[model samples]
Target: MVLRNIMIGIIIIVLVGGIICWTLFSKELREGKNLPLTGVDFKRLADGTYTGTYEGGRFKWRANEVQVTVSSGKVARIALLKSTEGRPSEFTNELYDKVIRSQSLQVDTISGATITSKAYLKAVEDALLKAQK
Candidate 1:
């Protein structure tokens, strides 16, 4: 009976410790939804290719980088330079296309990937900022 009680106590301690660690480690990710994103004016951007990065929030969980090409004062193309996660997913192209088509970072974020979408857009915005005149 004493052995069983000790085992149960150990298990409870492990579970509680895991929960505490998870909460602390994931705090930044949890707060990512509140990340603010702003769009730059295309008319004000000089014609050039600019590279920008989102340092992946405070902890760099989703850090990303992109190259933005502006020609004739409009976004011509955007290429992913680096991603925290290898390989762009299904939503990547759609998000980039939307930015190019609309020329803005105010597009609707991809469902179930809202934080990721914001991170990419933030990187694009960073690139655009460099081109701002």
Candidate 2:
């Protein structure tokens, strides 16, 4: 009877630990999930130069800056400009090509790095809006 209780207790402990881990991981995964970049209308942009920043105002992913330029109603070029202390910004950097190629923010976010993708799109949208003004 004592052995049965011990086994049950161990099982319960393992199950609890698994649940905790899954909860934490899921939250992180969701945050990294591609968030639909809403609230910015991209059609109102006009040809001009603008500057914007993203992931800078948030304490979450820690990427420093993403600067972009648009011309003739298309993404002319993008610059990494700056990044966080030690985090690799390459994956996020590559997203610019995808965004430009698609000519919209509907492209897929980078796997394993969704927050940065959202940040990049946000930054681009911001710059475009400023250019319009």
TM-score of 2: 0.44
On residues 16-132, what C-alpha lDDT tens digit does candidate 2 reach at each position? 999998987777567657444656545555777666655632335645566678787767777777766455657766777787776665444445544677788897899799989
- In terms of lDDT, the poorest run of 10 residues in model 1 is 105-114
| Candidate 1: tens digits of C-alpha lDDT, residues 38-96 | 77756588989999998876677778999999998888898888898565566777888
Relative to the true structure, how large is the alpha-carbon lDDT of every model?
0.80, 0.69
Candidate 1: residue 25 Cα off by (Å): 5.0
lDDT computed for candidate 1:
0.80
Compare the candidates by lDDT and give the number of the best one: 1
- Using Cα atoms with residue i matched to residue i, what is each candidate's TM-score against the true structure? 0.60, 0.44
Clashing pairs in 1: none
Clashing pairs in 2: none
Candidate 1 residue 31 Cα shift, in angstroms, is: 3.1
